[model samples]
Target: VSGVRDKMNMLGAVTDDGERFIALTPNQFNAEVAKHFLRAVQHEFGERLVIILDNASYFIAKTLKKQAAADGLLLEYLPSHSPELNPLESCWRQLRDGRANRLFLTLDDVNEYLSTALPALNSPQIYEYLC
Candidate 1:
C-alpha cells in the first residue's frame, strides 16, 4: 500500500424499497462529506426524498440541511437511541460484526470487504436486521 491511515468513514443509506448507497470517505466523516454524499443520493432519487438520519453531529449540520433543502430533499432525524428505526442500521451492524475481530492491512482490504458484503444487504431482506 502507498500509505497508512487510521480512519475511513462510510457514508451509507438505504431507500424504502431497499436500494443501498455507499460512499467511502477518505477520512473522518464531517458535514462536508455528508453534504457530498447527500448530493449523490439526490442525483439518484431526485427531488422530494426524505432521508432518515441518526443525530450524528455532521448529519445535523445547518449547512447540510440547507443543501438538502436546496436540492428538494428533506432530512429527518431518527429519535435518539432508536437505531431500529433506521433501515440501514442493520446493514451497518452486520458490517461491524463481520469485522469485529479482524484487521485490514490496507484501505483496499476494506474496500474488498465492502464489495463482498454489499450484495447480501442490497435486497429488501435487510429488514431482518431491523427486527
Candidate 2:
C-alpha cells in the first residue's frame, strides 16, 4: 500500500500591536526563505521591526542577520524550550487545530482552506496572544 504525502512550510509573525502575516513555502525553512519573510514584514511595516523568534538555526544564520540589518529589522530569539513565549506558536496551533479531523483531496484543497481559514485567524481575539 502507498500513501500520498506533501510538505508545506510556513513562516509567520504577529506584531505586539496586532499585525500578523504568513507565508507558505514548499521547501524547508532556511536563511534564504527567512530573508524573504523578513522582507515581506519590512514591506508591510515600512519601519524598524522587532521580531521575537524561536532558536531555529536559519533564524540565527549570518546571511539572515545581514538581511535583517539591511532592512532595519531586529530578530530576537526566545529562551530555549520556551515555545509558550512565542505568539506565533499559538497561531500555528490555531491553524492546525482549525482543520483537525478533516481530510482534503489534494494539496490545493488544503491551500484553499488555508486561504480562507487563515484570515479568520486575524480576529482581535487571536491578537490577544501577542500581548
Candidate 3:
C-alpha cells in the first residue's frame, strides 16, 4: 500500500436495505475519522440508524460509541472472526478484485477507477443475507 503514497483509503458501510456509502481519506484510520464517517452515515441515513460493526479497535473507540449513543444511533458489534456476517465483506472482495495487481499512477487514476467500480457494485446482488 505504501507504494502508492497518495492512494486513498475508504471508510464505507452498506445498509441492510442495500445502500452503499463511502468516504475517501488518506492512510490514517482512527477514532476521529471513524466518528466523522459515522456522522456522515447518520446524516445520510438518519440518526435512528443502527450500525453493525466488526471489532476493529477504532470502530469501538469510546468517544465514537459515546457520540453514536448521544445521537440516537445504535452500534452493534459482530462476534469476532465473523467476516461472513458482514455484507461489506463481499463488496470489499470485489473491490480488491478490481484492483488486483494493478498499479495506478496517481490518486486521480485510483479515483477514476473507483468511479466506475463503485457504481458497478451498487446492484443488490452483491450483498448476502447476514442473518
Candidate 4:
C-alpha cells in the first residue's frame, strides 16, 4: 500500500485471491496511478478483471471509474475510513516494520531493499498473517 504522509492518500491492490502487489509512491494520489495500476494489472494478468479500491481522493475515484468504463473493467470502492477492510494494509505494516523502518544511507539502498523484500511478501504463507 502507498500513502502520502502529508495527504490522505493511500493506494492498494490485490489479486482476486488476496495476493498483495502494492507500492508506496512518492507521487501524490491521482488518476495517473490508477491508470498505471490498470496497465500493470493487464501486463501481469492479461485478462481484464474487476479491481477494488478504497476512496481516498476524488481524482482517483473519477480516474478509476473512467478507466474501468473505458476498458470494460469492474471497479469497486470500499467504504471510507476503513483501513482494516483492506488486507494490503497489513502488508504495508509488515513492510514498514520490516524494511522501511530501517535507516538507509541512500535512496538506492532503500530501493534495493524494497526490491528484494517485496517479492518475498507475495508468498502464500505470509497471506495468512495478513488475514
Encode model 2's per-residue lDDT on 47-92: one tens digit a residue: 7878777888888999999978887887888898888777777678
Ranking by lDDT: 3, 2, 1, 4
Residue 19 Cα positional deviation in candidate 2, in Å, after optimal superposition: 1.6
Please give the TM-score that candidate 3 achieves against the real structure.
0.88
C-alpha lDDT (0 to 100) for residue 87 of candidate 4: 61
State every prediction's TM-score relative to the real structure: 0.82, 0.86, 0.88, 0.72
Best by lDDT: 3
Of the two candidates 1 and 4, the one with more favorable lDDT, higher being better, is: 1
Q: Residue 44 of model 2: what lDDT?
A: 80
Q: Taking the tens digit of each residue's C-alpha lDDT, what string does model 4 give over 1-131? A: 35523322335566657566555666665778767767676666656676666776742577667876788777777788987776677667776777645767666777777777777764234345336
Candidate 3 clashes between residue pairs 3 or more apart in a chain or in different chains: none
Q: Tell me which residue pairs clash in candidate 2.
A: none
User: What would the TM-score be for candidate 2 when compared with the true structure?
Assistant: 0.86
lDDT of 4 at 86: 65
Off by over 4 Å in 1: 1-4, 122-131
Model 3: runs farther than 4 Å from truth?
1-4, 122-128
For candidate 3, the per-residue lDDT at 42 reads: 91
Count clashing residue pairs in model 3.
0
Q: Against the correct fold, how does model 1 do in TM-score?
A: 0.82
Q: What is candidate 1's lDDT per residue for 6-89, written digit by digit as tens?
A: 566787877767788888777678898889999988887776788878999999999989988888887778899887777776
Best TM-score goes to which candidate? 3
